[model samples]
Target chain A: MVKTNKQKAGNIITALLLIILGAFMFLPIYLTIVMSLKPQEELFIFPPKLYTLRPTLDNFSSMFDILDNNRVPFSRYLFNSIAVTFTVTFSQCVFVSMGAFVLAKCRFPFSKLINSVIVTSLLYQSNVIYIMQYAVMSKMGIIDNPLALILPSIASPMGLFLMKQSISQMPDSIIESAKIDGAGLFRICWQIVIPNQKPALMTLIIFAFQASWNMQGGSLVFQEQYKTLPTVITQISTTGIARAGETMAASVFMLIPPVIVFMLTQSQVIDTMAHSGIKR
Target chain B: MDKLKKLWCDVRKNRDCYLMLAPFMILFVIFTIVPVIMSLPVGFTNFNMAQPPEFVGFDNYINLFLSDKVFTKAIRVTIIFAVITGPVSYMICFLLAWLIDGLPKKLRSIFTLIFYIPSMANVYTVWKIIFSGDMNGWLNSTLIEWGFIQSPVQWLTDSRYVLGVTITVQLWLSLGAGFLALSAGFRNIDRNLYEVAYIEGMDSKLQELVYIVIPSMKPQMLFAGVMQIVSSFTAGTVAQELVGFPSTDYKAHTIMTHAYDYGWVRWEMGYASAICTVLFIAMYVCNKVISRLFKE
Candidate 1:
């Protein structure tokens, strides 16, 4: 690709603009890290210095110190977060892929109906269903249980939709060939379908992980033992003025898993989507 | 009888699919479908947590519209938010995604991460501290130091500034999945078309975007549009997180926050469900209108 001088200048300007834009987008996160590193005394200082003159890990230590005193230790919350998020993401990716496989590859009665139901559910806000969800959870005897969080998230409409969209794009002959080879439905899904739908699966994993990771145990799993890191962070955040650094540290800690998951899987996610035929 | 026979035959033929779908469907029906349907009936009743619900048919809806002043304010605030943030974020997402698409892959991914971190990290609490009401808060301190204000302005607390501040933060976090979707859209555009268009002397970038990029990526554009509308309409968390649950004097009260207040805080589940149903209908209608725009 050859570029004229004007085009080169335009590219440089765009690059500079993007870098500045990136910094602006990231300023809050930068402040969070810097704030978490500041000493408690420095945290409350006037004009709220963006960068600390004297950095310390006291906030991190203090957050752990406080957690050490609780019946459910900090690691328990981390474990809860990890367990819930991983289970939800893994199960969701599997179930949605299965559902997507069925919808995409197999013709069945009510398949279109089921797909519409799922898409319609997406259009409606979840807040509308809060009371009933509570009632349902109570009836299911899962209130204050981690299952309350895990169950609802595992069959997310978005996950199902993404998988279905991706799966529908796959050539039908792959599944037909497997079927002719006397492959069972489950065998075909495991070997042929899931392997090909990696991009959508990755997308589902990211979304599901994020939703579970950020589950504020407000009504469903608010019990101390069942609560995830974000629940604890929200509780601490209300008292944010007094313990700003601790809250910031907790927020950053709570955020690490999703960011890590995203960084690791994002390239595969993009690459697969590139090949998934955007249009027929 | 005929339809049932046909359905049975179809079910038998696709029994394996039914088996595959059962796990997700059972959970989905129990959690998503049942709860949403239950809300429809529950919205007609007075169901405080203490007592069994008493059916009161449309009273909650009427009261919400005619009697609740704050509900009216919430609707206005929500519209103001959706009208501004929805389109702005959609356009910004497209523009940034387009620009990032032009970059090298390594740089593109890094840029994507930077733009995406706020929403991914759930960093609203960090913003809460930055916009803290105290004089020592970052925004307040910076403004005072610059002599922009004689006194510290309460970014979160003061009613006048609350809406503006919330909107700003919402816009910050808005470049999320929709941005990624659009970026993927740009990445997936066929390079052959671009080469062909260039060979034909269709050299202007903006023209290329209009003729080649958007038209080719209609599905992605529609997907991103739906995402933006859903997100914008349901944007209660930023206000609830940054500003208090019910911000000072209801300045930043959005319908979702109102639903949250009634659903959780007051435990007036029926009334809250009514509020939510209204929001659902509004979103559904908007979605329909938006979907119409994309129809061939």
Candidate 2:
């Protein structure tokens, strides 16, 4: 009876700790939801209420109205985000996985040099190269096109390194057996290695989706039609505090897709990290 | 000559491997590799977008060091930002992930989703409302109601409190991919190691973590370390978003924002390239130092 009480006490303490941490983690999100649902009158109330007695959909509707009133319709920005995100994610999955397989399994002259370059590139953020990249893009005649976005993200060094780390764990003997059975290297990569890396692919999808979804043209693509959802949201929100409720609602809209993708695939992603080992 | 011939033959033998690599490598070289290579020469010149680049050889670099007070301030701010956010966020990530490790799987995923949402969602615009400068802002209104302050505090605009607010939001958003990797690292530990640890007279969870968990988690930890260091160093976008660009008196100016100011806004492509080159070198050096620390 005493031992049972001790166990119960421990469980309660753990629950309390988790709730506190969870509250901290969830605070900003909770504030966002409440602020979005608030009407303009309630939004400015002194000692701002955490719980609202009167909630409304006016903010979301106004957000739509504000977006719809723009010269380019709201759907264009939405389409650009979705299309770019899908292209980047799909291409990264296909091209990066293949590159990772070759880098991991096949040995050729200067392979060590190549591998080190890829690893070093992991530390190279895009900020350092943004100007030079614009030059290259202009030279390539892709400055105003969506290709400027899709083409650069295809060779994600982090993705390649991550996929390589996971692929490296494949036993050499399995590849040897496949080689003995006359499987081509391409066949071996697509069939043997790629099929088993679903978890890693899902994780990459989450990352690539977030990044590509958030890709603002910001002088890269000047075409109004090609502008992404984030650029539009920022443009609208920065107008003033008058549209504060609508701004929150729009951000909530922006937040939904990635959250859905993460919810669906997080368990698998955790599993991949377990297997990938990500170490030296 | 014989060894060279053998190497050529081996290269030919791996022709299929080269074929598989060609598509991605072509794009990688064109986009990433060439830009990086060009930044070096470009940094030496005085290039405006319209005029051809005139080689001014070290003038920009010298100006940045000797005359540019903002650049120096940028360096100081970036260092402080990195020093504070990098290790603190890193420890928070590890601690939270460690604590959340053994929860029921459904509950675990829910908590993970809650924590991970901010970084993934790009919901920073919401912070603008919360920290709005006037009485209507949530924080100010609440504080005023509670008799904390008589008037509104300009959280975003005020120079004194700007960096602190940025840091707070940064900490909120900092539990990113590194957090995910660390949490997954805990789950992947061999269960038998703990049994052996206890049998070998490890009396507490703390000892087991030190002797068994951390050593085995070196790889994930290294990856997370590289990630945290990289993110902390380039943390510009958040500050730019929360506070306006060329923020009040340039209070939240960072190395990245400095690069942006010169490169994009000022149209000083060459000068901007120089700034970026400096930042690149600093990051490379820091990464080397970090990897060496992680070396077993």
Number of the top DockQ candidate: 1
Cα displacement (angstroms), candidate 1, residue B209, comes to 2.9
Q: Write the per-residue lDDT of candidate 1 for residues B137-169, one digit (tens) a residue.
A: 788788888899888778888889999999999
Q: Which lDDT values do the candidates have, in the order given?
A: 0.82, 0.80
RMSD of 1: 2.9
TM-score of each: 0.91, 0.89
- Tell me the lDDT of model 1 at B58: 93
Residue B111 accuracy (lDDT) in model 2: 84
Give per-residue lDDT, candidate 2, residue B78. Answer: 93
Measured with DockQ on alpha carbons, how good is candidate 1?
0.56
Question: Could you give the CAPRI-style class of model 1?
Answer: medium
